[model samples]
Target: MFSRAFSNPYISKWIVQGAGIIWFLGTFGLLMYYGVGQAVAIVDALIFALFFIFGVNIIDQTFNFYVPSGRNNSMLLIFPLLFSLVASYFHFQLLRWIFDEESLYLVFLREVFLLRWAVLGMAEILVALLALAVSKLEEQKEIKNREVMMHELSREAELSQLRQQLQPHFLFNSLNSISALTISQPQKAREMVLQLSDFLRGTMEKDHQQWVSLEEELTYLKMYLDIEHVRFGHRLEVVFDVTDEVKQLRLPQLLIQPLLENAIKHGLYGITEDVRIILRAYKEQNYLMVQIENPFDPEVAAPKGTGFGLSSVGRRLFLLFGRKDLLESKAVESVFTVILKIPQHK
Candidate 1:
């Protein structure tokens, strides 16, 4: 059980105002009916309104202390009744003091208990019940909010795990390329290591970022391409056709890297005279469009990776935007194309 004079500010204000009106009307009506002078009746009404409001607040707090929600003890009912009786006795004495008339004490005390205290006690009980309802609702809201926050944290943890997996997978592939080059061309192998260092440094700087500008992402991609460029030499070629308008538009960091890596793995991995990887970016009305196209031998199966290539891209885009249809892939003739329709974030 808790004692409170109010549940909410608006409700408390209106309750006090309404109770004051009722007290003044009742006091003035009774005094006027008993042939009291109008001046004394008005004075009595003002004093009665003040005392009644104060006494009602005490009754409300008393009932709240006894009649709390979600509990039903017989003792709870007895406490409020006893407290109301005591409060009524004090209110009667206060009125007798204000009126300065000892003869009126018995009649006033009788009226206080039988009429005023009965009505106000019931009103106080209702107020306590209303407070209980409000408290229950607030508690429920807090619980729901906490659950949502925990769910979001869990989701972020899962995404972080997936993101963490990408770095090791990429590092392993890069180290293998460096190993293969070290046996044949030690100079190129050392150059690839330097490029890898720069690339990893850039990646480390943006490790905490979920999104970056298209230009910034492209800068990181080029750092990656520098290493692949040394590995492939003239055998691998890339053509970038991006619009100036979409250059500064924000995109998920490392979103297109896996797709580009998959393209390189599929196209120029084995037998290649010359392979061209076409990369394009532009704005299509409200969405930013990115496309990657590469040639693959239809006779041979696509290179198997650690299952974090195109699927990872699709999953990440879905997680970020809540749209499953944003990443589209198609194989037409000898060319495989992946199209990304990213919603522009303002």
Candidate 2:
């Protein structure tokens, strides 16, 4: 009842403010006609202003925001008019006594008492309704703003979790390669072990960072591919085609690793024919473009994929860039390609 009625702040404040303003104007007008002291009138208006600011307006907000039960809402519309009449009566009586004049007494006895206070109090109620309307509008705006902020924050948290998932996922996959090679090609496996150490150290070294330069990502990619090369030898081939200019651009850390993992994951498996994976990067228009291409066995690849790497990269990109249109995956001949467009950020 009371809770539902004052459901809007603007309405409530406007009501209180309207009451205060009427009290203000009527008090001001009466004193002007009666020629009362300026100091007293000013003090009176200030007192009412502070009263409504802290008293009615601020207090009403508690009901509106927190205890918005249907039982309590009717108080919003009920109390203001009641308070206004009481306040008006006291104000008129006070002015009558302070002026101490027969003409002032007669003014109230005839016309002023019947018309001035009642008309002015209604004016205050209307103003209060308007105030509530405006307050509700502003409140809604603030709510929407807060929702947008929360969604962005949630996405960032998800990306952070996914980002952490990459390092261990890559390590587990690479370790398997090294484990397989260790038993068969002992000397090559020894070289891979050292590369694995450097690769893991480099990846884990930048643990707290959310972003890194293109050069740093390239270094990590090269180390990873080097270890894979040592594992597959001639069975695996990788080429980097990147321009000099875009090498220093910034990107979310650990981005390329998952894409590379995807490339390798889809590029090889159950094939007597050799496979070549090409990774290329360049600047096109306003975006930094990266493409990963790999050959052989698409039908068996998706089953092993578990749908994590490239799609996760796409989600992470949207969480960061606010755009999901930046990624593309296509198959041409026996090769599968993952193309990414990262917007240039300052």
On lDDT, the leading prediction is 1
* Model 2 residue-pair collision total: 19
lDDT of 1 by residue, 241-328 (tens): 9988899888878888888988888787555579999999999988889999988888886566623678888887776778899999
- List lDDT for all candidates, in order: 0.76, 0.70
Error of 1 at 128 (Å): 1.0
Clash counts for the predictions, in order:
0, 19
Task: Give me the displacement of residue 12 in model 1, in angstroms.
Answer: 6.3
Candidate 2 per-residue lDDT, tens place, 265-325, comes to 6776756667788889888887788898887575653546445887888888887878879
Deviation from truth (RMSD, Å), model 1: 4.0
Q: Candidate 2 regions off by >4 Å?
A: 1-69, 107-111, 185-191, 271-275, 297-303, 321-324
Worst 10 residues of 1 by lDDT: 1-10
